[model samples]
Target: MRESDLIYILAMAGVTYLVRMLPLVLLKKEIKNRFLRSFLYYVPYACLAAMTVPAVFFATTYVLGAAVGFFVALFLSYREKSLLVVALAACAAVFVAERLIQWIA
Candidate 1:
């Protein structure tokens, strides 16, 4: 909120940027390691799975209906279905599943 605080924040950001950028610039040609390359290849999938798994189970009924919804959408899309069709199917699955469960209980 103050002038010195703003200056300090700017300097910190500059240093952080340099720290992150310098490593890539310095290591770009040096990292010919196969293990690191393989690690990088799988990191994105690993991150996606990590985030999805926890998020899928974080809410009511473990977001169970939504998980089924996402799977149905993903599967149908994989089969060359239109995105809109897959999305509607998934939303329909969630709505129907939720209503059915509510009705049964």
Candidate 2:
């Protein structure tokens, strides 16, 4: 790669390393605040959803199919379905919705 690209990658790596290392270096003791602890516990899930939810809508051939899939996945997950079941059901929902849309068009 070009020198500029290498510099950008190293800069990104340094920033990422600092972000993780600073937290560990600064928070040496176990966090004891109940509210803060609870919030921290959910941070990873919140971050994951924040990253994943938007991509779900745009990753499919059609927004309508993706929406149908998202709802099905949401419903299944809300009902505490297994991960595999939720994923498969969502995929099936998307497939059916896309096919229906295609057929009707």
Q: Which numbered prediction scores highest in TM-score against the true structure?
A: 2
Kindly list the per-residue Cα lDDT of model 2 for residues 1-105, writing each as its tens digit: 799999999999999999999989998999999999999999999998998788999989999999999999999999999999999999999999999999998
- In model 1, the worst 10-residue window by lDDT is 53-62
lDDT of each: 0.79, 0.96
lDDT of 1 by residue, 67-96 (tens): 777788779978999878987897888788
Clashes of 2: 0
lDDT of 2 at 62: 95
Query: Which parts of model 1 have CA positions greater than 4 angstroms off?
Result: 1-30, 59-63, 77-88
Candidate achieving the largest lDDT = 2
| Model 2 misplaced stretches (Cα beyond 4 Å) | 42-55
lDDT of 2 at 60: 95
